[model samples]
Target: MRLNESTIVSASPKLIWDYIADPGNALHYMSGVTRWEVVSERRSGLGARYRMLIQVGSAEVGGLIEVVEFSPERDMAWSSVTGVDQRGRWRLRGVGGSRTRVEFRFAYGVAGAGITGYISELVAAPSLRRHLRRSLQLLKRQVEHERLRRDAAARQATPEATTA
Candidate 1:
């Protein structure tokens, strides 16, 4: 099954990309993700690997995944190297001043489980979609908050603030 979701974040693509690229930040913004651990020495670029898991029904599903594509502040994609078959991508585009269009795409299925796999994928679609939507909302909240914090910090550091 394939799922795609997008949201507009009131922050630059760079800010959102920085947050999503860091594996350490995943759990904070990614709903249903119970575990996201860097399994390779490299952390945020192409060829980096992570052991990840997400809650599905009563089970945690996922495995070792490797970063297959990384394009700085634009796109990052990963494919499962072990466990269930899955691929995911994060795409970012600057929409306007300090705003970004962020998209999350995911596809997964059991390769050999036949009819059972098809039915399971169908059954899991709704839950997965919900997770994706919620994750984007959380991400929007986080990056926008960070942007505000950074802007506030910048304002405070100016000479005007000290004089006032």
Candidate 2:
């Protein structure tokens, strides 16, 4: 099954990319994700691998996933290396200024369950969709909040020029 969701974030594409592309921040924004930790020595960017798990109904499903594609500040894609069969991608488009359109897509199915896998996919569709949407919403909040905090700090750091 495939699921797609998108949201506009009040932050630059680079900011959003930096936050989402980092495995350390996954648990902060990814809804239902119970485990998100780098399994490889290399972390963040292409070739990075992570062990992940997301709640599906009463159980958690996921596996070791590797960054298959990485375009700085633009896109990141991953595919399952073990466990459940899955592919996921994040696409970021800068909509001028500090606004970014963030899109997420995921496709997955059980490897050997055949008909049972199909049935499970069908049963999990609604919950998956809901999780994806909520994830994006949480991401938006996180990025925007961070942006505001950074802007405020920058303003406070600058001293007012005294009129001569």
Each candidate structure's TM-score, on Cα atoms with residue i matched to residue i, is: 0.96, 0.94
Candidate with the greatest lDDT versus the true structure = 1
What TM-score quantifies how close candidate 1 is to the native fold?
0.96
lDDT by residue for model 2 (1-164), tens: 99999988989998998899778899999999999999998898889999999999998999999999999999899999998999999999999887999999999998789898899999999999998999999999999999999988877777463222
The whole-model lDDT of each prediction reads 0.95, 0.92
Q: Which candidate leads in TM-score?
A: 1
RMSD of each: 1.5, 2.0
Which 10 residues in a row give candidate 1 its minimum summed lDDT? 155-164
Instruction: Candidate 2: list runs displaced more than 4 Å.
Output: 161-164
